[model samples]
Target: MPETTAASSRTGRLLAAPLALILSVGSLTACGPTDDGPHADGTRPSSVTSPSVTSPSASGPSAPGAPSVPAAGKTAGTGPTTRHTASSSPAAGRDPDDPDDRLHQWMESGSIPMNASYHWPMLDTSARLADGEKFLFEEHCGARRTPETDSLARAAWMEKARPGKNDGDQNWLAQETIAAHLQDGKRKASALFGGLAKELQACGSAHTSVTYTTRDSRHVAATIVLDKDTARPTTLHEYLAVVGDNVLELSLWATPYHQDGGNKPDVAWPGPPDTSVFQAMTTPVCPQGKQC
Candidate 1:
């Protein structure tokens, strides 16, 4: 196993929070063509990576060691809603499907309600957030491997982890890679959100809102509304607590909508990062004006 540096660890914490948001909804949804939305060319994107399990190698635990499960019955309410920020808007030409459009006719007809709720153990805790970020990087960005297999691994992981099982070493690789990227300033807000918009567009709409709550509890929100449908799905919601210089406790949430009109289905649990069908997170060696 490769050693992760302290700076890399800090980056993992920050990136983990927001990156967790990106996978939350997608991981929770059921596996299927509808779940794996088509790409811009109307093709299903690849999945995230998974650890090789030829044998149960001696490692720490099946899941990353972190926050203990919340008290058996205690539940956290949906946090307060903050105003939207400007940078959160979707990109140009990225529009949402109209509520009245035939494409979204199922939702527009009201048979699905167009609204749903999803809840988990609140994996946003500092430790889990760090782990989640690591998973995203190793799985999507291919920090230690080539991108070709990384893409396939990501898609496969998403499909398999739909059940929420903790992934082994592969998950750790992803978490570490993401931490390194964020610490290097290669994964800033703009780049992070932009990539998220592109990913969400595959589901149904690309519009998104991002909210960050400071340690002091002050909340900041940013939104990007796709030009097509005008729907504002929340791609990242998190809390940033001061850690050290250039670092903070990052908590994240990613929610994509399959608008089913006024009667939307319950938001599915995207299981775990292990089964996500998306590219790994990586620092583009030479990005073009921040649009990696």
Candidate 2:
């Protein structure tokens, strides 16, 4: 089985456009360890390009409509991009049920574990940038629509795991640039997550969009789909993975928000998508963050 993913990105008021599609997050490649390695200040780079597990798509990072925040009027990045007491990750062999095994539980814990079969897992190594498959949605910062408020210091991590036997019961996908940051970053993350979560459930029978910021201060854009009607209603869950300084995000889709009731419309949208590399909306997962 393959991992469920929803690709996305943010620029200003609009989210990176790649988010509009299930930009398949094929097997991911690293931007070289150093490209995503920790900095003296404990901060990661603004944008990173991970390798692809599958072949590159005709439409990739250069996909038109990807959002970005420009300089000038863009809001400032919040929190401590300059300092932090970097902590070690729990050993992969650590006990899963052991509460102590969740040192970076704040990162994602099991919010979006890979399904049973697929053993392929890709890790994200940035507090503020896209990781793994999210490499394609990268956007620069600018004078676009960034969160106006300042932010607090934050932390983040990423992974692309494959799950086998998606029994539809736990058959959901997600894509996130979730993180734990300063009050300001928290607010921004909250706004983007909350905004998308609310709308994912309300688009009765329509599609939606995604938006966020870049490390360079740019606004971005993405997209969302509407109401699902199937034996297993498409359920989408969007939230912040915050636990103290370790705040992160989870864009999981387990059930439908606005499941169709009355009758199957003439054109009942197909229930979600397949187990392709990248997933989207009810059918897929949110890309990076709002951006992803």
Name the best candidate (by TM-score): 2
Off by over 4 Å in 2: 1-114, 119-128, 131-174, 183-247, 252-292
* TM-score of each candidate structure, all chains considered together: 0.20, 0.26
lDDT of each: 0.27, 0.32
In candidate 2, what are the lDDT values of residues 1-292, reduced to their tens digit? Answer: 1232222222321554455433443223233236668766888877766553222323334435644333444454432441222333212133335443333322232323342322312222222232212211121101122233111111133332222333533344444543333333445555544433333233334333233211111122223322333443433333332323232333444433333543322222333222221222111233344432
Candidate 2 accuracy as TM-score: 0.26
Poorest 10 consecutive residues by lDDT, candidate 1 = 104-113
* Model 1 backbone overlap count: 54
State the lDDT of candidate 1 residue by residue for 196-242, as single tens digits. 33332232333323222221221112222223344533333221211
Deviating ranges (above 4 Å) for candidate 1: 1-234, 249-251, 254-258, 261-292
lDDT for 158 (candidate 2)? 35
> RMSD for each model, in Å, please?
35.1, 33.6
Per-structure clash totals for the candidates: 54, 92
Evaluate model 1: give its lDDT: 0.27
